[model samples]
Target: MKKLLIIAVMALSFGTYAQVDPTFEKEGDKVKATYFHANGEIAQQGYFLNEKLEGEWKMFNENGDKIAMGNYENGIKTGKWLFWEGDVQKEVNFDNNRIASVNNAKTKSPVVIN
Candidate 1:
């Protein structure tokens, strides 16, 4: 009896930990966003179409600043991607999962004197 009870408890615990959360997906007419995380901070966020990433996507830093933005088509990156670090910004051109060029500001753009 004790051995059977122990086996049941272990099965329950394993089942709980192995469960996977469902991702966002379009239902009928509305689109949804899904978040992937670690340590309670958002690691990735994007629209989900049929449980796959589709359309524009934005990634944020732990402090919540916009870190990167790009377009996604059928869960694959398409078009251009922009990345930023502090005052520096870089633009990367992408073609069919390949990076074509990267342009970075050699010197910071001057503030507009209004």
Candidate 2:
């Protein structure tokens, strides 16, 4: 029992410091990057131009589920971003890091015929 407790403590301690390093690949003048979660799952992925976030980026939750996806230009958020919240999916459009619009889609209930 003592040995089991020690192993559990070690595992928890390691999890506390778990980190995922980003991998970069050169593409012309920009570099593409993929960041992983502590569980070795992809957390976020996008491109960098001049060392700034650019192009399309995707973010996932720790469970490897897509949480948000959008585009960036020179570290500025642009285009539409989709986010998952409970049973609803929210779409946010950004322009130059500013929110331009928002749309939400929720589950619809079906009607029963008499």
Per-residue CA lDDT of model 2 for 29-104, tens digit only, reads: 9998999988888999889999899888888888888889888887999888999865578999998799999998
Q: Relative to the unseen true structure, what is the C-alpha lDDT of residue 3 in candidate 1, on a scale of 0 to 100? A: 100
TM-score of 2: 0.76
Which candidate number has the best TM-score? 2
Candidate 1 ranges with C-alpha deviation above 4 Å? 1-31, 36-41, 106-110
User: What is candidate 1's lDDT per residue for 1-114, written digit by digit as tens?
Assistant: 999999999999887555334366565653666454433455466776765677788887867777899988777778889898987889998887789898995546767966
- Candidate 1 displacement at residue 51 in angstroms: 2.9
Q: For residue 108, what is the lDDT in candidate 1? A: 63
Alpha-carbon local distance difference test for all models: 0.73, 0.88
Residue 102, candidate 2: C-alpha displacement in angstroms: 1.7
